[model samples]
Target: MKIIPQLLFVIAIVIFGYFFSKRVIRIRKNIQIGRKEDRSDQPAKRFRNMLLIAFGQKKMFKKPLPAVLHLFIYVGFLVINLEVLEFIIDGLLGTHRIFAPYLGGFYTFCLNFFEFLALAVVISCLVFLFRRNILKIPRFWQREMTSWPRLDANLILIIEILLMAAIFTMNATDQILQTRGAGYTATGRFFLSAQLIPLFEGASTAQLILGERVAWWAHIIGILGFAVYVTYSKHLHIFMAFPNTYYGNLNAPGQMWNMPEITNEVKIMLGAAGAEQNQVEAPARFGAKDVADLSRFNIMNAYACTECGRCTAECPANITGKKLSPRKIMMDVRDRVEEIGSSNSDEDGKSLLGDYITKEEIFACTSCNACVEACPVNIDPLSIILQLRRYTAMEESSSPADWNNMFSNIETNFAPWKFAASDRFNWSKE
Candidate 1:
């Protein structure tokens, strides 16, 4: 009987180690995708940004309710891990109430509190899923008709439910195991366990024991499987959000969009005029020629996507049916990243700004900053598109006639509107 817990613990530990190591290696490979050397010299600014974004979650609140709910989910998950730690100890070491002495009544209180909070998170996620799927929020819908909007939402809900269920069962199992005296005082505090006890009145010891084992194993298996799922699905945000947020830009949002000097050097070296330099020496032209041109951060952006479709919901081009959906763009980027990561062949190479992402889509952008402002994870797709445009205009000299004329007018007249300098003060005079 005692050996079961020890075996579960060892199995859990081994699985954890294997997954953790694999993810670390994958992230490292992703970081090398775009391979831009770190240029920030301001240690203080970087440190402050790391603290604020990673812990403060400043960027997440652009969509307030979802942000706040997600924040609670994160904190609740972290706090609840202590309960798991205690479970492993009790199950394996025979210390049934290990955390009781150290945490006093606090562990009990937190277990109950976080359990309820976790429930709220699950409910909120369900609402979000409904909004995305049944309600058919237009913003999150993809253009290729290939975006897995419903699947994405369903997966997230499943993860949240599994996590919450695990917590509920673990608590309930403990309650049953300690039926003689309410087990631990902490166990009594959990509302789920308290409610469950009444239903089990007059149950046999063997039945109770069997139920405990079932619940215990269910909790363990659910959590273990969830850990694996996170790495492969959009729910990867569950683990990556903190680290990604920590590395977030500290500078003003606008300032961070500026292409680094390395990008410029690459442009010049390749004789690429504008943003086209992003494709220089690259097999495919820049913007996002295949997925290798995309930075690790870009890949992270996809996993971190909450499928809120705030960017797509706000995109002007989508509203006009111009074939540009920011949400679809994100999905495409994610697909490309996965495709490249999984294959050794270069057959999938595609231009970032060409047929892969149409010129109309490129020109449709207004540089209005709406998409950037709307993204929950701070993904700046607008900047990526613009860089691709720059590469087209500067390196390949392949800009649209209307846009070229507009740029020429801007250089000759200092305004895209083509108004003469003499007429600049006409409005003021009138």
Candidate 2:
């Protein structure tokens, strides 16, 4: 029977690893399907950005109340997970409170700290749920947030609350067992957990043990399950945020990434470089007709988007009732990426261009920087929109009549207006 329990623990670990590894590999593969670009310049600056923006949640602080509330979940979840290492060890070795004897008082200090975080996480989650469900904040009801995105947010908060509750219950029952002179070993009373001691007071040894066991199992297992679930959920930003911020565009908002293929062609045409020097193997396509046509960073940005609607809320186009929603653009990129990654979804020959994101939506963009400035995670929705817009205009030659005339004027007269430079004096005389 002892051997059987050990075998089961090994099997559970293997199952979790298998699923987690598969999801990670799939995401990596999907990201790699995109075109490559060099974002390797300035490693030190990138590191600082990752630390300050992603780790510090600097942008979130602009909104004080929600930022503080979110900080609780961010810090609490991250800090509490350190205890998971001990939980993993204990589970494999069938040891209860494995670090109690080794660390002595320090273990108690750590547990107390974790208890405080756990309590904060629970309270924060409750408040988040209330803000989303009961209060029904306006930004939360944006068009992009109507269905799964809304439910996904609520579900994650509820799961976090339950996970925190299990941790508290586990510690509470362990404290009871310790005071009764049970063999559970004394790790010292955790402050927040101690408050719940009365609930299990006077319970039989068997009942207390069962409660402790259930809570312990629930927390560890729930954490493992959540680890797998994040890869599939919008909550993936938790893991992707660091690297996404590091590779994020550091250019001023108005400085767009020029299409290198187009740039090289232009250099050749202008005689700035000899055809041989400018000559490279032509790409199969230009701009972004699909997720694969986009750069790797853009696909990663899609995965990193928190879908907080800040982008949409700040978008001039969205506010004006245009077809464009910057938030929806990111969400559509992620959804189409998912479809492309799944078997046969790409077989229909439809893509992000006309199928998911419409031409009208792409045309509505005024090249304003509000969405980029408002994104807390530095997600570049405009880049995706412009890429799609480029494909629509340049590759497909489908620009609206007005835009086509503007393009013609710029190409012929070297300006957006149709006129000869010599003829400018006629207007000046008037």
RMSD, each candidate, Å? 5.2, 1.9
How high a TM-score does candidate 2 get? 0.95
C-alpha RMSD between model 2 and the true structure: 1.9
Write model 2 residue lDDT over 234-254, tens digit each, in one string.
899999999999999988889
- The digit string of per-residue lDDT tens for model 1 on 1-21 reads 758767767777688769867
TM-score of each predicted structure versus truth: 0.79, 0.95
Model 2 alpha-carbon drift over 4 Å, by segment = 267-273, 425-430
Candidate number achieving the greatest lDDT relative to the actual structure? 2
In model 1, the Cα lDDT at residue 426 comes to: 88
lDDT accuracy of residue 30 in candidate 2: 82
Q: In TM-score terms, which candidate is top?
A: 2
Q: Give the local distance difference test score of model 1.
A: 0.65
